[model samples]
Target: MDYERQPYRRCGRSGLLLPAVSLGLWHNFGEGKPVDSQRAILHKAFELGITHFDIADRYGPPIGAAESAFGRIFPRSLRDEVVITTKGSNPMWDGPYGKGNSRKHLLATLDRSLTRLGLDYVDIFYLHREDAGTPLEEQVATLDHMVRTGRALYAGVSNFSPEHTAEAARLLRDLGTPLLVHQPPYSLLDRRIEGSLLGVLEQEGVGCVVYSPLAQGLLTDRYLGGIPAGSRAAEGRFLTPDRVTPEVLAFVRSLAELASARGQTVAQLALAWALRDPRITSVLVGASSPEQLEANVGAVDGLEFTDEELAAIDRAAKEAGVEA
Candidate 1:
């Protein structure tokens, strides 16, 4: 696919090079969408220079469906051409060993994920979330084991706080396995990471693959006029109608206007803003259609920002309560 045509960034100190924009299967690519439709998105993303596809056990509605569906369309020719990341630590089944960061659950889920992915090993495997009930040492050891045993080439952590991330990095370093990446939600509407997480990752030399860079589509023009029919908000799942409040919509509209001035869509602007951080390895995005994916890929075309534009974005984001 000549994916190298696009510049890839090193994941922290690791040798892994991920595209600036990665596709995420956190939404869509599941049972609700037709198999062919999902396949088209994957094809289009690959053609656009995206090499990373993020997946998790609990992504699809029925859970595990996203990985299974993606596995079905995953071409053997492209397997080595791309980087596939799957996660555990979220509940996909009932019972004591069904979820959490316990070695038992993490390893079992990795095996199941490998079977569903139709691959012996993933490019990266993540501990989907922190388990308050589990000890940090145990979780880090489990991830280290995954890499040692060749079930995953690298290890990552997601939805972890800055403090936890720092500790995890320390543990992984001692085990001779540095934390490869951390997946967190970061957008104009969500800047919690900037307060501390970003610095931690940079200091620890851990790359970041941020998800929800579009704030669940609130940063896009799609919700400018209000939630459209069949949209995630209208469906009242991850993004409910109530979440698209007057304040948030107002913020989205303002961002859209600024994007128009830059001759870019709101989605593109948000994505480019995310990549502005040198510590960010990639901005993980999810698409409902091929067109959406194409537009997102365009984000890379114009990522430059003048000081004035950066200030304006900061002002708008603060006004929108992103900093609050």
Candidate 2:
């Protein structure tokens, strides 16, 4: 593997350096997908210098399937070379303790995740989302315990508002387990983070690793003509068919034109745009195939954008009713 092919960036003020394009096992690494295919994608991602792999306990259709699949292919020799991250806080089992940010739930979930991944400890363990029922102190303390107990090397949070993120960072810092990263959804279609969340991460010295960089394949050419037979939208999982409205298609077409001029795919353009901000440590990408992974990672080559191109991108987004 050409490690230098993909540049590594420091995650905020932390000593950890994650690949600019990390692989996420949110969609394809489940039981439905073939094991050999999943293995191919994982191998190809590592071959392309993607050392970070992100997963969540509730990522699979039945939950815990992705981790199990990953465990089957993950080589023990390469454990030291790769960064494995998993999250909790979503419902994964029966009973009230099945999911929450409480200490009981988080600790139990981490143990189960480790068993599924066949790992003693993950590089990062995140509270998947904010749980209002649980006090912020308890939630933050749970993360601290995870790190302090050697179950996780670092702590992270996902889908957190700016206020929650700031408080968590402060609490974790006081506990001597500084927040390492914040994972949020970001893309041309969704620029919600541009207003406040990104600012908080920068001020708090928390690295920002964004997911949905391709907007669940909307930013790509796959939906240019319309949703295909077996697409994410068709399955009505996270993205619905109604999301492929005419306005969204028009927005995608405009970006596709811009991408053509730059000799990049629309997906690559979206990834590059998300990574354009220095505050962004990495952009998590999900690939169903090795070819797709290669194409997405190529975004690193054209990370720069001319002022005029940036202006045009903003104009397209604004015209498509995307708020800045």
Candidate 1 residue lDDT tens string, 85-139: 9999988788999999999999999999999989999999999889999999999
Candidate 1: Cα lDDT at 149: 98
TM-score of candidate 2 to 2 decimals: 0.98
Candidate 1 lDDT (Cα, whole model)? Answer: 0.89
Candidate 2 regions with alpha-carbon error over 4 angstroms: none
Residue pairs with backbone overlap in model 2? none
The segments of candidate 1 whose C-alpha lies over 4 angstroms from its true place after superposition are: 320-322
Q: What is the number of backbone collisions in each predicted candidate, taken in the order shown?
A: 0, 0
> What is the per-residue lDDT of model 2 for residues 134-156, given as tens digits with 9 covering 90 to 100?
99999999899998899999999
lDDT winner? 2
